[model samples]
Target: MEPLLTAHNNEATSIAQLTAAQQKLYQWDKTIAAKHLYLIENKDTPYERLTTLKKHLAPLDATRQRDLIARYKALQTPPRGRRVEEWLRSWVEITNMCIAADVPETMGSRAQEDFLVACRTINPEYGTSGLRDLIDLEDAGTAIPSVEDYVSKFTTYLKRVLPLSTGLSSMAAELDVSKPQQQNKDGNKNGNKTKPQCPCGLKHY
Candidate 1:
């Protein structure tokens, strides 16, 4: 808890660069945006899907709320030698964003799983870690002025937790190979070998 701002600055820069996590989150973000989630919430087209997403996200969201409440309660008592939660605005936002990005992750879809699976994009210069300090006196904390402070922290958090890639690319690649079409579920026409069954144990020929 080095002043909420500097807690993570010493972290290695490489940790902030997106490997596959940001790509995943970007994909989910695209899906959510393309569907216009808010507009379709009450309509029939995307309502069910959006509702399902929210349902899946509820527990994660609730846990974040619960964590805040617990932290608040802890602050009221004032731990003898620890950083207070009331001053870690950036820290709070970062934690919340981590949970927010986790929404797509629990759905079990390949895109949701891989997209932004890790939020490695948060750089120190603009992130919240530069705001909070380690000293815990009763003095008030510095108020973050620029919007970039919040944006950097949350963006990095979102990217890190974002889902992995949509697996569609790999699926498409597999489909692109020119394998002889199975004449039927029974076997290949040339009789080299029978077609492999799908995961469901059913021949998809």
Candidate 2:
């Protein structure tokens, strides 16, 4: 059974009492939740259940997005080769939820579309039509394709996308550009401060 079913006694635990993983798995996307809840209620196969549970969504707010993205990158294990693959694969899945167009309007669809395009951009070898088909699925809110039909190809597609170091650097740079700047208590963005500088390339004063 999924953690959700066993999360807590329904009557005793308010929605607020669910764990972080439970909240993310069950509350992140309504479309996803509906599908998964049905499968759980009907005793669907484990594969069906697992695939529907999307996690670490990078959130909608730019500030939260940046924090989570950075933390995910920072906390990765064996931080080298396979690390990058794992990260991109996760984004592919996470973006699929957004692509399902189930995200809040505040989150918008552009980011999801842009993300799929990005995966394609990293791997021109994936072929345009193949990428387009995936986009089409996302367009129809069926981004989670049948496991046997698309999972293998999708795995291969992502496997060929980008190297860990390259993907990490690129993703980080993109997040840095897009995420809202960190603000100080003084209401300064990124602590907009200057320091006395020598030709040592210190911050400008």
Candidate 3:
């Protein structure tokens, strides 16, 4: 006796009026609804009489169903400034939506493939080979894998790749060159005196 059968009076309540949680509990997608309707009508299950009596309930709204495959196809990978943790949080949100919508395309393998595809677009030089090179490099010195290995490894890869992708290496070189010039200016202002030792008792010179 599932709660869906006895919890509510069908004559008084419509399916559209059911809460999202209730719809999920009853597995109320279109295909599932059809199957259940058929079973109820044919008196196929031992609970057939109870189900048939409630068969007049309204169907879930077709428009409320999401096309998860299409949504993922259109999903853009977050830009470099966005942390991988934020991106993963967003993916988790999407997964919850898919489960609520009863989307069939939300399998873990499909998610992993989609994640890889999104990541490849971030660094096309990786050439979409499942990020093998980047993964291997990140894992090179690590002996033990943890539950968060996937996130940690991918995060390290992004940190390494984003600098290259965003011209940060050249920017860093320019900054490095400017530092000597600024130091010379400061040295002149100080009349060529050795700078005072740092508070930590270390001399920069």
Report lDDT per candidate: 0.37, 0.45, 0.49
Q: Mind giving the per-residue lDDT tens digits that candidate 2 earns over 57-164?
A: 333355554544554333222133324446555554544543344444214444434344444543444536555766787778874444223434645544343233
My TM-score estimates for the predictions, one after another, are: 0.22, 0.27, 0.35
For candidate 1, what is the TM-score? Answer: 0.22
Flag clash pairs in model 3: none
The CA lDDT at 36 in model 1 is: 45
Q: Model 3 Cα displacement at 62 (Å)?
A: 4.4
What RMSD, rounded to one decimal, does every model reach? 27.7, 19.6, 11.9
Please give the lDDT score at residue 183 for candidate 1: 51
lDDT of 3 by residue, 1-119 (tens): 23343233264255666656545434432334344544444443335545654554434433444455456455555444434456655665665676567666654344555565675
Candidate 2 off by > 4 Å:
1-83, 92-112, 134-152, 158-205
Clashes of 1: 32
Give candidate 1 misplaced runs (Cα > 4 Å). 1-28, 31-45, 81-205
Q: Per-residue lDDT for 26 in model 1?
A: 31
